[model samples]
Target: MNRSDMNNMAGSPYLLWRVGSLGLLAVVACVLAIRSFSPTARTRQGLMLAWAVAVVAIAASAFVVPEGVSDRALLNRIDPASGVKCATSIFVLSLPIVALLGALMGRAAPTQPRLSALASGIAAGACGAFVFAFCCPFNDPLYVVVWYSVGCAAVAGAARWRLPRRFRL
Candidate 1:
């Protein structure tokens, strides 16, 4: 609507990516929550749907990385020490929430515990990463790829590991 606002948006190309990525993640999380918790036939169709959601989430998150940046440049910008810390912290913070959601869903769907757990894990990871994108000022493609995405995945893995113990009826 205004020139200054337009200028700011133009300067921050990653804003578009952030908005789109978060929107996509939100949708994926909801879809996963619904399908994963529902009692359905443990068939190939269901598994394929889960795989599709996972793949879409991964691909969408990857696109959050800026384009036209060379690998060398990205690598040079990487701060492995800080990145690890950031990723770890985000994952650790998100795990409990993810675990709680998984547990609630798992109680209802005892037929396919693994599938439900996987869906919840992936959804939780996406949700966590999306939230991180807002606070993280760094729009470096490498940072988004390495820490944010990996953080989501780490949360997912941790959730999966804790699935049986916490979700068991």
Candidate 2:
């Protein structure tokens, strides 16, 4: 998004709804991730639960913003890129977070290191999407679903792949 394009959206009337929805999902994802890391709780909850939460969070965040609240013009402006830029931005925003979550989970060394790392990644990805909500003005459900999901998935996948190695035993 260009500076002026961003400036133009300063008063965008629909931001509140998008941010609120994304924020709530982010919180849920974070909670699940944190819980999944607990050594005592690792067995009780595992990869399936982590994935379930991420899927639910994705569906809700995508559909939360209603259709009538915003016009198609904004999306038209962004439609050319097909949200690739947004995905990149979201990934960039979440990278530091992913690294931190990985380090924490690695240190904890839960019984299920792989699962915990995957959960950490999912949570970090959700948070990254949440952080990008401020800069993203497009309320298009399709746009949100496709690009945001990609961005979040990228982070989560990275964490999952790397964190399992922390467990030597």
Per model, state how many residue pairs clash. 0, 0
lDDT against the true structure, per candidate, is 0.63, 0.70
Top-scoring candidate (TM-score): 2
Work out the TM-score per prediction.
0.71, 0.74
Please, what's the RMSD in Å of model 2?
4.2
Candidate 1 lDDT tens digits, 1-169: 1233444455465666665565576566647655666677343354465457556644665555555544556556567777887687668667766867766875676456665666667677777766666666555665666777678778767766777465554
Indicate which candidate wins on lDDT: 2
lDDT of 1 at 133: 61
